[model samples]
Target chain A: MRAEETMNKLPANPERATLEGKNKFLGFWFFLGGETVLFASLFGVYLGLRKATNGGVTSQELFELPLVFIATMLLLTSSLTAVFATMSLKSQNFKAMIGWLVITVILGFSFLGLEIYEFNHYVHEYEHTIRSSAWGSAFYTLVGTHGAHVLFGVSWITLLIVRNFGRGLNLYNAPKFYVAALYWHFVDVVWVFIFTVVYLMGKVG
Target chain B: MGSHQNDSVSKHDQSHLDIHHKIAHQKELKQHIVSFAMMIFLTMLSFIAVASEAISTRFAILFILVLAGIQAAFQLYIWMHLSHKGHQYPTWGIFFGIGVAATCVAAGAAMIW
Candidate 1:
């Protein structure tokens, strides 16, 4: 009888509780930092090679400020939805949290769709393919990397939502939800830079 | 002695989960919503800045980039919860990584420039 009670009340395995979760959290943050540098390098390359447009489509001519601005707004709002989901998690409101996450995923998908259409429009309409010039290559590389990050975030969140739909909130799943929200925020941060460096700066310079 | 006893009693009370804590959490959620609204407004302002013909292109670019930087900081600190956490080591690690990346980008640019 004593053994049964002890087993029931055993503190959550520290390996799973503090150590492993903390390691995953810290490692993910480091990974995001690495991503920042990856993006910074691409931005630098894009800046230098920006003028080597080979007299093809130029930033001033090709970039449409209005469409990019709308896309930016959509992504920024989705970041907020993810925040609400995290808040729900903190309050142990599992249903509310899941609801917010689903909303975030939808917003993310819309943003991705818009980006795909924008890229296609630019390439087909403006004759600005990635293979056109150094500028085109750098442009696609930097912005494409960001798009890939968004796609990854969407997939990550979707899987987490489906996996946890029936599990409910417990110590085991709380950290998973938390990490997914972290990834969503990281993607938002990257979009912030992409808007500034690629869209805003391109139009200006 | 009596006050010390009261302090311990209150501490015990604080340890117990209650509805007040949930209410406070909801209030915090409202603050988060307000922050999000502010960010949305700022994003729209940037769009206006970009679309307007009167604004000098150079100033428009600088304004938008600076605004994006501010928005990024807001998302990281508020939404990501990095600011409240003990993030000193992580901050240093990421910044150092950025430094190395900057060097690589500079070198690559120089080679191709």
Candidate 2:
């Protein structure tokens, strides 16, 4: 049977669709919505505790714009690559989709690596640790949560690519790919906020 | 009976075509790129505002927060496609989420202050 025939045989309710596909798709988006709130709360707490640095290290003394700019570029470029991958998926160009996803995954990994390096530099050079003060705790919690999302996104996309390598795009997998792209975009969205509230505002303050 | 048969035949033909074969409009991709560029520019502008030393710290904080708000709006509407057609549910979900977030921020700030 053709792919459509296979999909047709699947159920209607998205949550109960065969291949356990649509269920994961709708469920994941809802999960991401919850995650947005989780990050939002963290951001609120961070903003409230922003001035609680206890004279450990102020924002201007700690943050370097160039490194952050590079990291921002990496993540923004990754978001574009993810869009390309989704486009390829829509066009049924599985090979091209996979290629774009590979690029996106690499960008995400490099972004995570840079974030780790950035954190280490802050801790070692600036003596900024999560335990340093309330600001340190809030800073790490907010930005670290975003970093964790990026790390999760990288791993999620990598797993999707590996699991669906031999299998081409079908309804069973299309929603999965679509939601993964959505999650990637969400990560980028959160970073945009982080860049503004944490880095830029921190610098100004 | 004959009309019914024709209807079934057409449905059969349509079902064979995969929706994924449709190419996304190039214009949409261009729009996304433009929006991404705008957000990057906004980010840089905030950085410049902070580094300039011309603005007072209080004003700088307020200005950067406004810029951040604008960038967040761009990311949501454009990158996340939250404002697009067929995304009504997600749009509502995110807005409701933002409302709660704003309240939390206000209350949290108040409590801490």
Candidate 3:
């Protein structure tokens, strides 16, 4: 009777029930706030130095709109997939949530792969190494940091799936999945800026 | 007698949960689909503005930046559900981050290269 009562009292969002989960939720937001500052600084630097190419290949010569546009679509769609997974979690469908999360991770990996190819092509084709010019250095460091976040997100979600496989949607596991989805969406937010401030502005300027 | 009462109580809880969840699912489904479609449209519009020469260079930059801002807002409020109830603190957290970020942009602009 007691166990059933506890189960019966489970809120729609089982994730936010416990104190620990609430703390995790709020603390993670603070961390993301700090990340916002970090990225902002990098962005400012990239803006300041993007034109100081020291006579190397210019950003205009290197950026292809079609490729960057496709990558942007991939990450944006992944954000929506993560949203679906969160909805599934709220609706108490663990299987469907996990399925959507798997799709999110795959899209993340694809974005990372495209980024790697983009950087390699620039370095080889235009001799745009970080050491080549001030512009090159700012460009790589700023965009590379965002790519690293994507790699980290993909790995984090993969580990969560592996560790929680066969585990039902209990309160403990619910918060874990919820925060991972949060982190994935945060990564998507950063990418929206990257494609805008970095790629789009680079093309325009 | 005790066991029979327990059985009835559990059944009642199940029925209540089913009704509640069904309504919520419908509302959330519409929210997600609408936001997703809007975000995609905004993205395509920005891309087109940049690709086409109908707009001047400076206007295009401002136009796309505004689009990006709106898209980010959609991702935060809709996809991340920050607009939902009981999200007061996290909302503060993100806005605080944005405040600091805006300051950084200002400082960086003033510093110049």
Query: Can you give the DockQ of every candidate in the order shown?
Result: 0.38, 0.37, 0.44
Candidate rank order under TM-score? 3, 1, 2
Expressed between 0 and 1, the share of native interface contacts present in candidate 3 is 0.56
Which digits, one per residue and each the tens of the lDDT, describe model 3 over residues B2-59?
Answer: 2112434666766775687789789988988998899889888888888887878798
* Model 2 chain A: ten consecutive residues of lowest lDDT: A7-16
Proportion of native contacts present in model 2: 0.42
Q: Pick the candidate with the highest lDDT.
A: 3
Best by TM-score: 3
- State the lDDT at A183 in candidate 3: 90
Q: What is the interface RMSD, in angstroms, for predicted model 1?
A: 6.9
- Top DockQ: which candidate number? 3
For model 3, the stretches where C-alpha displacement exceeds 4 angstroms are A1-9, B1-10
Candidate 1: which stretches are off by over 4 Å? A1-17, B1-16, B98-112
Q: Give the TM-score of candidate 2.
A: 0.84
DockQ (model 1, Cα) = 0.38
Q: Cα deviation of A46 in candidate 3 (Å)?
A: 1.0
**Model 1 vs. true fold: TM:** 0.85
- What are the per-residue Cα lDDT tens digits for candidate 1 across A59-138? 88988887887798788888989999988776667899999999999999999999999999988899998999999999
